[model samples]
Structure formats: structure tokens, C-alpha cells
Target: MKGIILTSHGTYASGLYQTVKMIAGDFPNIKIVEFHEGDNLENFDQKLIEAYNDLTYKDIVVITDLAGGTPFNRSVMSLADKGNVAFLSGANFAMVYQALSSEIEDLSEFVADVLEKGKSSITKFDMEEDDEESLEDGI
Candidate 1:
């Protein structure tokens, strides 16, 4: 089994978790850590430790809202020596979904797949008018 940890500033982690749950139902070994206003690095460390300890999976994937932010930096430091852990920044629903649902045994491969999926999922939606205009122009 694998696990997922979502960490972010403010409520992004929690909100993203809820959205994932709404779409995919409750999953095992999934956790969220929110870094609220006035929260210190120690606070984030504690929360992350708690979440990491609670997971039953050997391979854990941690997703953060921003790269080089407090949550992301602390997570990187905390899991630095942990070979079973992988870190991903700029988390979104698609990445979370893929992480939770994937049954891939290889941690590196799984992380790579999720990263590719996450990146590919992001796109600009064109309005109908613009789409039609582009189609008419043979785009």
C-alpha cells in the first residue's frame, strides 16, 4: 500500500483533501497538514510528524502547495533520509487523485507518473466563441 500527505499554507491542504474525498470517497493512509497564519515551523514539523507516523504505508508521497515554501521546505528536510518518501510541489486535484488511486509498486515510477499526470492536467479552457473562431480559422 501507499500513502499521500497534502501540506499547504492555510486551508489549501484540507480543502483539497475534502474535494478528493468528495470525488473518490474516503481513502486509506491519506493525511492533510495545514500551515495556518501565525503558525511556526515547529508547528508544521509537529503536524507533519504526526501525519507521517499515522500512515501505515511504506511508500508515502507528500504534495505541497508551493515549492520552497515553509511546508515544502520542512517536508523536504523531514523526509530527507527517508528513502520511501517522495515530495511534490504545486499540488492539485488531479495529482491527489492519481496518487491515491494508483496501485503502482515502484515509488519512483509512481511519483513520475503522478507528476506527469498533474502537469498534463493543467490547461486553459477556451470559451465556445473562441473555440469556434479557432476552428473556423483551421487552428
Candidate 2:
């Protein structure tokens, strides 16, 4: 089985996990490491280590809130040389949901698919314009 770790600078990690649970119910092999205001590198390191150690899966995927932020950096350094670990930064709800629900055995392919899903999920909505246009079209 593959595991997932959601890390973020604030409560985003926990919040994202809660949202996922609300939609998909509880799932094992999924964990969250939240970095609070007073947390430093060592704190993040410890949290990551604990989360990694608690997982029963051989292959693990870590999703961070920002690409170059502390959480992402710490995860990268902590998982370095760990062949079974993969990192995916700039995480979102779609990515988390897809990852938890995914049955893909190939770690690389699973990460790629999740990244694509995350990228495609981001959209710019102009609701007023869209509604006006639709009304004008008599649809």
C-alpha cells in the first residue's frame, strides 16, 4: 500500500485532511503534519519523521502547501535517499482527494497523475460574465 503525508505551514494540512475525510470518509495510511507559527526546522523534521515512521506502507507520497516553503524543503531533505518516498508540493484539495482514492501501484505514475489533476483543477471563474453571456445566448 502507498501512504500520503500532507504538510503545510499553517493549519492547511489538517484542514485539508478533514475536508478529505468529510468527502471520502476515514482512510488509513494518510497523515497530516501541520507547521505552526513557533515551529522551526527541527520541529518540522521531527514531525515528518514521526509521520513517516507511523506509516505502514513502503511507498509514501508527501504533499506540501508551497513549492519552496519550509514544509516542502524539510520534506525534501528528510526524504532524501529514501527511494520509496516521493514529494509533491503546491498541494490542493483535488490532489489530496485523487491521491487518497488512487489505486495506482507505480509511484511515479501516481504522482504524475495527481500533479496533472491538481494543475487542471485550478480555474479562473468569471461568474457574472459567464451568466450574462449565457443569458444573452438564450440558453
Candidate 3:
């Protein structure tokens, strides 16, 4: 079976991680690691490496918080010529869910589809506030 690594900006908040875990529930063997905690890039990198080494099987996917940031960049560093690993930043629970539950056996196809889905999932939501709309109501 494939393994999953859910990493964020830093070490994940326990509550948020649990929520993601709850939503991602059902994978027989998926692992998660958070990378950013109080700007501790060193710890994040180490934990990410450890998680990668431990959970990797025939296929492994790493979900990062952002594409060019320390978490993603450092995780990419672990790839020194290794190709069995797949990395995804700009991640969300939906993408991880898809990766965890995919039915395809071919790693390439699975990774391809998952990456497409992940990239497609990012959207331009309107964060700019309107004078009339409340933040709660997306005004």
C-alpha cells in the first residue's frame, strides 16, 4: 500500500492535524508530519526527512504547505536523484484524500492524477473585504 505524508507550514497544530486526520480517516497506513512550528525550520526539515524515510513504500506522497517555502524546498532536497517520491505543496485535505483513496496501481498515473487534482484545487477566492459584507458572510 502507498503511504501519505501530511506536512504543513510547520509542525501542525494538534487540533488542526486531528481534524485533517479525522477527515482523512480510513487509510490503512498513512503517516503525517507537520513542518513549521514557531519558525523552527530545522526541526521541520528533520521531522519531514524522518517521516519520509519511515513511511515510504513503493510510492510516497508528501503534502506541503507551500511550493517555494522552506517546508517544500527542504522536502525536495531529500530527493537527491530519488524518483519514487512525489511532492505536493499548496495542499489541502481534499487532495490528500484523493491520494489516499486512489485505486490506480501504477504509481506514475496515480501521481499524475493527484498532482493535477492538487493544482486544480487551488482557487482565487476573494479575500478582499467589501464595505457591505461581513467577514463571516464573505462580504
Candidate 4:
């Protein structure tokens, strides 16, 4: 089984974890680390190391909220040397949800698919003229 580690500044990691749990129930191979305000950098990095060490899965993916932030940079420095680990930034519900819930045979393919689907999930919507008119007419 593959493991997933989510880290973000503030409560974003915990918030995303809760959202994932609400949607997909609890998962055994997923962990989250939140870099709260006033948190020491060394301590946060230690927490990340603990999280990484705790997961005994064959493969792991560390997902962060931002690319160049502390969480991402620290995670890379800490876990990049470990083999079979992937890193992703700008995390969203769609990607994390899929990554935690999926059971694909190929980790690379799974990550690629999840990334693609997550990107595709970003969409724009514009109400049509008829719908606007109906709303205006109280239909």
C-alpha cells in the first residue's frame, strides 16, 4: 500500500484531512501535518519526519499546499532522499481525495491520473441567459 502525507501552513492540512475523512471515511495510509502559527521550523520538520517514519508503506507521496513554502521545502529536504516518494504542491480536495482512496497497480500512473483529474476538476460556470431570465421572473 502507498502512503500519503499532507502538510500545510496553519490548519489547512488538518482541514483537508477532515474533509477527506468526511468524504471517504478513515484511511490507514494517510497522515497530515499542520504547520501552525508560531511553530518552530525545526519542530515542524521533526513532526514531518515522524509522520514519514510512521508510515511503513512501500511508496509515499508528500503533498503540500504551496510549492515554495516551508512545508514543501522542509518536506523535500527531509523526505527527498527516501526512495519511492513523490511530491506534489497546490493540493486540493480532488487530488488528495483520489490519492487516498485509490488502489491502482502503478503508483506513477495513479499519481499522474490523480494530478490530471485534479487539474480538470477546476472549472468555470456561467449562467445562461434563459436561466438568468427565469431567476429574474421567479420561475
Task: Give TM-scores for every candidate, taking all chains together and pairing residue i with residue i.
Answer: 0.88, 0.87, 0.68, 0.87
CA lDDT for candidate 2: 0.87
Candidate 4 ranges beyond 4 A from true positions: 129-139
TM for candidate 3 is 0.68
User: In terms of TM-score, which candidate is strongest?
Assistant: 1
- Give the worst 10-residue stretch by lDDT in candidate 4: 130-139
Query: Sorted by TM-score, highest first, which candidate order results?
Result: 1, 4, 2, 3
lDDT of 1 by residue, 23-131 (tens): 7798887998988888888878888888988998979899999999999999988876777889999899998889999998999889999999899999886785466
Clashing pairs in 1: none
Clashes of each: 0, 0, 5, 0
**Candidate 2, 5-109: lDDT as tens digits:** 999988998998898888778889888998888887787898898898898887999999998898888999988667899999988989998888889999889
> Taking the tens digit of each residue's C-alpha lDDT, what string does model 4 give over 32-95?
8988879998998898889999998888989899999999999998889987788999899999
Candidate 1's C-alpha runs over 4 A off are 128-139
Predicted structure 4: lDDT: 0.86
